[model samples]
Target: MRKIKELGEFGLIHKLSSQINFRASDSILGIGDDCAAYPVKSGKFEVISTDALVEDIHFKLSTIKPETLGRKALSVSLSDIAAMGGTPKRIMVTLGIPKKISVSFLEKLYSGFNEICNHFKVELCGGDTVSSPKCFFINVAVIGEAKRIFSRKGAKPGDLVFVTGTLGDSSLGLKLLAKNKTRGKDHKFLTTKHMDPTPRVKEAEILGRSKIDITSMIDISDGLVQDLHHICESSNVGAQIYEDRLPLSPELIRTCKRSSIPPLPLVLNGGEDYELLFTLPADGVKNLIRQFLKAKVLVTQIGKILKPGGISMKMKNGTLKVLPESEGFNHF
Candidate 1:
């Protein structure tokens, strides 16, 4: 008999997912991709995904406000829809409320939810609320529609890997918040990034509508290297990312310099960036840049797909170092 820790997060997921033998024909996608897609009469696939945020693990009550938490709770799940090249339509929130929570907190939380929903034009459907013994948590389910769907299984050796926005800022912000150093002017932007992450819904929509052939996609919720590994695993291809090609915000670089820590670790291994990590044909790079530029979204080419079997990083010294799958956060 094997324990869960021995199997690891992906192993456990594979184990459980393999046992689900009752998938229907209408359910074209399930378990493996960011969201499960079902074809509908509207000439689109209805994609659905859910994510849970727990106290201490996902956030600290002392660090984040209830409203910030609420927006983030939904944002995380929305990223999944974006990964599937979908637009968010409706959302449902399930709360594990502790006795220590107040009505004001819940009200502020809903206000945050309403603000985002208005911007995205998403409907606020009903959900369940339950009392908890101690720690509070939130589970958000988002339903979306995609005219053209993307999955993790499409990357080829010639695909060029791209990532949206800057990496490492959010994770570094979380680190700074833990030490209560999030008050200064320099820390403000990074800290806010850690709290309020924007799901790349519009950007994904642009890609889906564009002529570019986006081979594979996943959001950077679990770190760049870790999430990119998912693409490699699914597509049966390898990747080689250049350290210098990784996009980093000035604030993240300065913060790393000030703290005397390396930025690469945070950029490659830290989680909760919520940006899009995707792959497309090398020929489509020009068009991808043009489309995202008009939208004012930054998409950086950090790597390339290979025919081999492992993920590697090209150092500044021009050495290729293999990155272990254990680089990212393990939920277990």
Candidate 2:
């Protein structure tokens, strides 16, 4: 038998999905894309996405506030709906709490969930609370609707690739928090990023509504290269990203310089940025960029798609290096 570590998260998902023989016609999309979509009414589709955060693996109570944890737990799942170009409407939360946790903590956590849901105008209908054997865990599921949907399979060879906001900040932030360092002026920004990531709901909505044809879309929950690999595998194409073209925030650069860690690896392989990575036709790039600029949204064109199915990065000195397919977080 193959070990789960070797299979990785995606491989494990594929393995399990292979065994499921029951799928209805209404299950229009299942187990593959960011969310599962089902037709609800004429010209509209209902999409649902779920994500879970564990105690030690996802966050530590000592380092992170309970309220922030609650918000982040929901934001990550909302990002899935955003990736599918859907607007969040409703959410259900399930919590596994340790017996020792206080009522005050639960109240503060629920407050955090309310804050985020209110900001997005989403409803927190209901959920279940259970006693955990050891550590606390949270699972959030978001239901959304979209007139038009974006998926991973639409990119063509000549399409251009783009990413919203910056990459690697959240990953670097998590590193700083783990070490308990609190020195640099930018450290707070980094820590906040890791502790409270904003889902790209509005940005995804703009792209979905834009006239420029977005060929494919996905949020960068995993690293950029790894997430882009999903687009490539689904679209049956390849990608080549330029190292120089990648957008890195000033805070991330300064923090990296202080830590003496090369930033490229983090940008490529680090996870939990919650930014959107997408592709569109080369001809539409100019208009799309213009549209985003008008909306005061920052989107950078980093690369282009290829006919071949692989992932590579072009170094500053002009050497192309192949990125390993499995170079991202494995949740197994």
Candidate 3:
């Protein structure tokens, strides 16, 4: 038998998912997608997705407050619905509580959940709570519907790649937290990026309902290059990213200078940005920009889909280099 690390997270998913069978007639999509979908009624498909966050593994309780952690727990899961261009209707949460956790912490966590739920107009439908010998973890599931679902597949040769918001901020934030250097304006911005990530639900809804056709879509939860690779593999296409074009915040650049860290590596490989990475034909670029700007969301074109081959990047120095997606975060 092959070990889990040998297959890696995505590969393990592919291996096990292949053996599983689905008999549900309404099921339009299954494993290997951001969300599973099935047609509900009148051209809409109900999409569902779930994710788990564990103490120490996914986050450090020492660095994050219960309220912010609670908000992030739901926001991360909701990003899946956004990737499929769906609006969230409801959510369910499951908790694995260890003896060390306090009742007040749980209450504040749920309070955070209630606040975000109200903001998104999603109901807390159902869930379960269980005791664990060690490790506190949370699993959040969301259900939503979409008129049109954008999947990883569908990129054609000439499709332009775009990403919402800046990249690498969250990754930098994680590094800062890990080092116990949580001070300064730059640190605060980056730390907030990691702790309180915003799911681009509104942006996704507008793009999905707009006239511009989005060929492929996924959220950058696993780094920009890794998520883009998912779209490429599913579409049976490749891509070429422009390094300078990749979005970066002034805070990120300045903070990296202070820390003596290279920003590009973090931008390409850091996870938990939670921004949407998408593609459309070159012609759709203009209108997409206008739509995004009106919504006050920054959408920048950073790459282009190429004929089936390896994924590469054009550096600021004008050299092209093939990128290895394995450098990204993987559970295995």
Compose the digit string of candidate 3's lDDT tens values, residues 1-332: 45544554455444433332323345565444565555567778989999999999899888899989989999998899999999987676778877677656766687778777777876565565677799999999888889889899999999999999999999999999999988999999999999999999998998988989999999999998899899999999999999889999999999999879999888999999999999999888889988888888889999999999979999889999999879888999
Per-candidate TM-scores read 0.87, 0.87, 0.87
Whole-model lDDT values for every prediction: 0.84, 0.84, 0.86
Candidate with top lDDT is 3
Model 1, 252-308: lDDT tens per residue? Answer: 988899989799999999988999999998889889999989999899999999996
How does residue 59 of candidate 3 score in lDDT? 92
Question: Across residues 214-332, which tens digit of lDDT does each residue of candidate 2 receive?
Answer: 89999998899889999999999999999999999999998888779899988999989999999999889888878888899899999999987598889999999999868888787
Deviation in Å, model 3, residue 95 alpha carbon: 0.6
Q: What is the lDDT of residue 54 in candidate 3?
A: 94
* Candidate 2 vs 3: which has more lDDT: 3
